[model samples]
Target: MINRILVVCTGNICRSPTAAHLLREALLGCDIAIGSAGLGALIGQPIDGAALATLECHGHRPQLHRARQLTAELAQEADLILTMEQGQVQGVIQRIPEVRGKIFLLGKWQGELEIPDPYRQGPEAFEHSYGLIERAVASWAGRLLLRR
Candidate 1:
């Protein structure tokens, strides 16, 4: 019955967007709508170039997306919210207590750690981060699908 999902990261320019793309592709059978946002967001920016390249390598062609501020309304609307780090989960919950149960780390379910922001780090960092996003999203989607 989960009909909408929101992925979160620091800037929304890299990690979250990549995770959204992977989830959309892998969970194609689901009725859920997937999206991403940032906590300390650079609102209205497109996905980073290196992130685009990394997704392309993975056979994912993501559509246009602009970063948006995290709001209580948004958090309340989503059926689930996935964040890159523990701090973001706390931030979202503090702002919108209703999202408590649905909030989780994109990394933890995949048996790893946080997906660090690679902004300004260089292509190598973007590549590494994208790999982490892909793996986490795939793992999450698989578990979600099974539950359905």
Candidate 2:
């Protein structure tokens, strides 16, 4: 059974954290641990304001989220690793080949959709990204619930 999940993107401040929080909510009360990191993280940074606002608008109270860089140790710890984009999958596997079997696109169930980054792109971009992430998270949650 998958117990640990890691959501990943280029920067932790946007896509990854958003997905992670949504996933955490979706998997609430389950024996699953969800977290996020970035390939090129803005370490110590908080979630992008627009992303935060979008999440709040959607009723997800994301806690004190701080950006973190993806590390081999973190990758190895996750039973499943979800990436926002295809390139991120390659980037993670290329850096940590041992995790190749566990890494997948966050949108794997949504026609292999990729969640785009909305950094500095304003509210519309963040909203669009949030919608995609929400759908992807729902898809994964259903599959994961079945596994449980």
Candidate 3:
């Protein structure tokens, strides 16, 4: 049973938070916990407006998503750490080696694609990023929610 999972990205304001919401909704009946963080977060800021709006369109609005910094302590506690890209996963692995097998790109195991950061990009970029995360998290939930 995967008790906890952490979704990570360059900033918690966008990708990770969106991924966390989808996974949480998909695995609502399970006992697992889902969370997200940023490698270079601006702690306490709300998610960027466009990204939040996109997620809202998908029926998810995270209530209290204060940006969180990536810490070894948090990484060590997670059962699985899913990132948006392989490079980001590598960064986490270097910082918290204990998270080894558990640290992986959210799109890696399945699509082998990278969810590009839509930070400074326009709505189209955010929309594309949202699609990537939604599919990956949905697949993750399916596997994680299986009854043991």
Which candidate wins on lDDT?
2
Q: Residue by residue across 33-83, what tens digits does model 1's lDDT show?
A: 998888888899999888888888777789998988888878888988999
Off by over 4 Å in 3: none
20-54, model 3: which lDDT tens digit per residue?
A: 88888888778778888999987998888888999
Clashing pairs in 2: none
- Steric clash pairs (candidate 3): none
TM-score of 2: 0.98
TM-score of 3: 0.94
lDDT of 2: 0.93
Error of 2 at 26 (Å): 0.5
lDDT tens digits, residue span 128-147, model 2: 99999999999999999999
Candidate 2 residue spans exceeding 4 A from truth = none
lDDT of each: 0.87, 0.93, 0.86
- lDDT order, best first, reads 2, 1, 3
Judge candidate 1 at residue 68 and give its lDDT: 82
